[model samples]
Target: MSQAPASGSIPDSTALETGASEPGARRPYLTRTRMAAVLGALTLVLIVVCAAAVMFGSVPVDFTRAIADRTSPDHAILFAARMPRVLMGAVVGAILAAVGAALQALVRNPLAEGGTLGISSGAAFGAILAIVLTYRFGGGSAIVPAAGFAAALISTLAVYRLGQMHGRVEPFTLLLVGVIFNTFWSALILLINSLVNLYQTRSILFWLVGSLEAPTYGEVAAVSALGAAGFVWLGWHARDMNLLSLGDEPAHDLGVDVDGARRAIFIATSLMIGGAVSVSGMIGFVGLIVPHILRLAFGADHRLLLPASFLGGAAFLVAADLAARVAIAPAEIPVGVITALCGGPFFIYLLRREGHRGIAV
Candidate 1:
């Protein structure tokens, strides 16, 4: 691996690594030694954290016993509550982080995140609207998350369309548009909140702040399916993402259909973000923090960044969720708050050090 430039922006020297061609040999996707090592370690930690999350809770049942008595209340607690929550957190965190990485790269701004681009807020508005309507009329079953997904998709498209100027998108313009749209949606959400009753408002409040308050088995299954599909779609274009860092012209010259690829990726990522947010509220930090951390360690190559972010995000969220569980025990604080507590300050530090140049937000 080659060394990073003297600026010290990238944490590892791997960003300078280059490929050399050998006759009749397949090209390698990644060869960053440090990044591979970190990815392996993070994967191991994620596995342990997932297991711990499933086993640890208020009831505190042993995994062995829970496995033996799957039908009992304790086992039910493990299966119906903790396991689903942990699994869903893993999926959601991975998707958010991966999507964040893509958006940061696509927008060429370090400050850019899924929520910052207005997708999450749009999803929140949709979810709240669904809750409001369901409470009032009651009937359509799939309208809840479906509305959220639609809102997220529409918001992302709006951002993309509005940000485009002379056939290309400007990073600063995109950021400004996103900020404005997000504010508009937030105000609308407040109006809805004002109209709703206290109990419904309380539910919307927790959801807006972001919570993983044990989703239903059906929701878990739906989110899993969506995340898995999104991951595969992203993985297929991972190499193209690396080329995108060199700018649109070079990527297009390299035979990447820049617009088409971006379109596909944008849609898939919106689905991933919207579906996760719909199920678990607006858990922050995972998307905003995890991908940037992974980029620091793994360089800008999406081949490694994508998978590494998936594992690292999973580990980070599971750890945060564990802390949320243990911090208050019976009460159990929201996992999103815990993540923000840790990630928000780190984000500020990053901004202080690397604010002006090439920051995507």
Candidate 2:
């Protein structure tokens, strides 16, 4: 699952060239300045898509008036019903993309993501546990997310530890370990559901399917906070993630502290995944598919891959969520279901390509 480029592809140096006047001076097109322009274009596209998402829904509301009138019904619908969900999609999309970028580098596994490796499941278990505890303690919605965050962190740590074999962690081994952990956690969740009352079971089932059914303002704010933190933190590590594509030994020889970097990435990835799970509850494939698509579209440099995936991921989820809302008309579909339905085939396609021709890390 590692997003490393296939052997013999031109390096990112094409984005730059020697100055026209000098033999080796960098050229205008290949300059970092142009890369910034590309990123700006992506950002512009994402903004337009987000605006479209905010505008299209069951009851089409004029966004201009909605934003201006705090007391209008359209405002209520836009602010209370739609805004949070849109923001959640953006946050989750960015977090998932960033996590995918990091994990692919961390373990050199392209398929690595919060959902695939049981991190989301683990986080869900924690959140569920918190919910049960809150029910007993007479707590509120805030407690639920807090509990979920703890669970997500714990689950990711457990997976990381177990995935390590003889002081090394291979992508395939980590994938296997993640599957096992995912099964265990999923079963645990089911067991908890069984022991709980019927109401709780129904609630758990709904949450498990994943939804963008308009989060509370508090939830949206918290998700935004965590997501922003993770995004900022990971942006600093973009170069490290790029270097890591060469594999751990080579990365180490190049002065990258393999173990320390892995630890940081793991923690960062867990936090991002946990935050996303806490808010969105185990949406799958944004991570796996987003990075791959970016890889194909923009090449494998993490510098470009990371931001492109983020923008692409945000657009992808928002569009899918919009589809889920309109496709069923009055009855909204769980966003997770839609993403899986759409992304599953793409995932299979990726597998087909991998089987036919492998990328060397």
Candidate 3:
């Protein structure tokens, strides 16, 4: 999946520019001024989406009363219910998209994402297993995060290692790895679900479908803190992300700690994925769709792509959640359902487009 671009195309700046020369000046569309403007606009969009998510649920909220008067009934609906869920959605989206952007660069795969690479499946399996264990054993759901993290780390490394041939992640190898890992984890999750009691099965199934329920400030804070940490880690290595696209041998020759950087990045992304799946189930496509769109728009400079993907993803998931809340009125659907509806077609389209462009069959 190393999208090094076919020789015939006037490849985007992503394929052509080395960050070593003139930095942001080489990409006319991705200059420093333009990057800042794009990021600012994305921030504004996220804010607007968040506000809309808060206000436009099935129950009409007295928006001003909720904000100004803590005693009002609307206040509970806004602060105690909607706000935390919306915030959680935003942070989860940010984590996915930011990490996805980094993975695309690291894997040199235009189509790389958490779902496509099996990270989400791994985390979801971990969280699902933890839920089953907690019910069978006496421990609370607090163990979910640790379980999810460990599983996510293992699955991530397994896929990343298998996907890489020599130093590069071959497109065919990555696709096969995704299929194998995803099928394996999903089957295991299903097996666990089949054995559990009705109540436990319901819980496991909810996560499988992906929901943003049990809205609470604690969940928001936990997700935000971890997501922020991962964001910083990826941002710190944005330069290396760029260099890695130049090939591992070339990158190492240019002073990149290839092994160390790859390890750190996988760990950071796995941490974020585990935390998110533990809380929000398997919310799909935020990681895949957001970064792919941003890279296309901003030319794959991880420096610009990461932040833009974060903001765009926040807006996207927030909006998707809002749709999930109201799309069926009073009765809401899973957020994952909405994302899959959007992403499934997008994924097929991307594959078809890639095929037409001469990507390997």
Q: Quote model 1's TM-score.
A: 0.86
Off by over 4 Å in 2: 1-31, 62-70, 139-142, 359-361
User: TM-score for every candidate vs. truth?
Assistant: 0.86, 0.87, 0.89
* Worst 10-residue lDDT window, candidate 2: 11-20
Q: Write the per-residue lDDT of candidate 1 for residues 126-164, one digit (tens) a residue.
A: 988998999899967678778988899899899988987
Best by TM-score: 3
- lDDT of each structure? 0.80, 0.78, 0.84
lDDT of 2 by residue, 304-332 (tens): 78777778788888888888888877778
Position 196, candidate 1: lDDT:
85
- Higher-ranked by TM-score: 1 or 2: 2
Best to worst by lDDT, what's the order? Answer: 3, 1, 2
lDDT of 1: 0.80
